[model samples]
Target: MVPVDTLHDITARTFASDNYAGVHPEVLAALAAANGGHQRAYGADVYTARLQEVLQGHFGPTAVGYPVFNGTGANVLALQTMLPRWGAVICADTAHINTDENAAPERVGGIKLLTVPTADGKLTPELIDRQAHGFGDQHRAQPGVVSITQSTEVGTLYTPAEIAAITAHAHGLGLRVHVDGSRLANAAAALDLPMRAFTTDVGVDVISLGGTKNGALFGEIVVVLDPGATPGIEFQRKVDMQLASKMRFVSAQLLALFEGDLWLRSAQHANAMAARLSTGVAAIPGVRITQPTQANGVFAALPLGVADRLREQAAFFYDWNRATGEVRWMCAFDTTEQDVDEFIAAVARAI
Candidate 1:
């Protein structure tokens, strides 16, 4: 046997995306614990079963979770199962499905996205009405589902009442509701509410529950709050190539996040770091906070040449909008106060 050697800097950090952060130690421990045992394949194992019990405790007994490999797969599978061949989804133009997924929902899932431009990366009932029409028009793709992202792409949040309003309006228009809850934990932490408070209790039909961003090595779940709203998901998961052959490991990671307070604790810390970063940077000359810091991401508009200079210092982040010189900085569960402070200093130097 050969020993593995480290290939990268162990202390390197980035605000590019939470996905860049390493796995939570607790999730790694869960993986180690689930390793030695042989379990049934393709979601028929004890760990998979236990995951359901745990999710039910959080989301209620009517909820059922199907584990998948990533957020894109979970989103595609959830939407694909909720709609028909000609069915389209209404979402904000800045949605991950519309922008970040590289058209996986369109190319892979064969679903059309009816996107509306939003100033704050959120959708209102009036905004939904923009695409909610044309139901019986033969030339148009039928609008069957409305998908909203929680702790949205620009780091904005949808309150419980806001979500409830969208759900009610969508249902009245015969459209099912889907929440792309990849940052759901951050929302829960910021709102000081449980998972179901803004979801199941508010009439959300389905959710794409995130794991990798919060603390897991890799995984997400397609949680059905209203089983009748999404049909054929069990079969569609495999059809979309999201079914993991060694399902217990995936289930174990999800359980590690949801089984206790790990999810909340990690999210709260990340959100706090983002708030700290937002507050620190807002005071700097020529830096403008562009959006509300309601989650684990901070969006700001930087002066020309500032972002490039900051990246040169090994403090990496992404440009949210090149036209506006806006950049996005994401804080992960592992991001420490020192990391935030050092990055703040770097930004000051760059400016």
Candidate 2:
């Protein structure tokens, strides 16, 4: 890890990505508080119970949660639970499962992934229907799962109504619906809806409830919303190496974050910061907003010279659409108005 001083010494520039920012204070404190504890191994401690309570509140008393290392792990483990030996999963073309999972769903879980087109990082019912073509023909891969990202990688959100529509269509077609809530907290806060408005009520079968992105350092809760729909899920998690041996510590962080509404607080702050950055960047000359800043991410096509100048300052960001020439700016829990303003000033100087 780069030293904090080294990071702080960098020139005046803010990264356009949420992942670039550091962990929030509350999460860090939870981790520190858990440092010297010797309780139980493999999720049998009080902290794990607390964390489950946190999730139960999110999805009502019927929901359960498990902590995994990362978003990808949480997603693959959760998806695998709902799939049979030969059943396949469906997702957006840009879904992390389709583009980013390194084929774990296929290689490890022995399931296929069917990808469909996405508009603004969201999958509509029309898109799902379009991709579900030729299923059960014995001539094509079967469609059995609907996996969607929230606060999608492109920083867009699916409204509760939109999710309900997609879920209804997928369920009617005899498919289980999974929400890759890797950024679910962000989407929930942005929509101003209760978590259950989309999860249990909107027809989600399983949800990879996110904690890593909003605030937690390394924890994502795989919430089993439909117990009957996904039996043998706990065993799957254990076999897949997602079951935290020291589960209490990880869960403690979540409880401290979620049970008291810290998750929404962090996500709301990040969304606000992203909005601030988007507004600032759009005002600058030669910078264009590539997408609506709906969540904690901003996509733009800045002048090449401006990008170069920002990079020279050790600013962290990524060229999301290199061929089309655009960059992705993600905001995080700790991002401040000062950071956005500084980035704006740097852009002003460069442009």
Best by lDDT: 1
- Over 4 Å off, model 1: 1-4, 8-11
- TM-scores for all candidates: the values are 0.98, 0.93
lDDT of each: 0.94, 0.81
Clashing pairs in 1: none
**TM-score of model 1 vs. true structure:** 0.98
Q: Candidate 2, which ten residues in sequence have the lowest lDDT sum?
A: 11-20
lDDT string for model 2 (1-351, tens) is 888879776533356555555667887888888777597888888888777877787798788887887778888888777877767787888888887789888888887888777668788878888767676677677788888888787888888889999999999998899998877888888999888998898889898887777777777878888877677877888888888888876787788788888888988998899899899989987889988899888999977656766766646677887766588878888777988788778777777
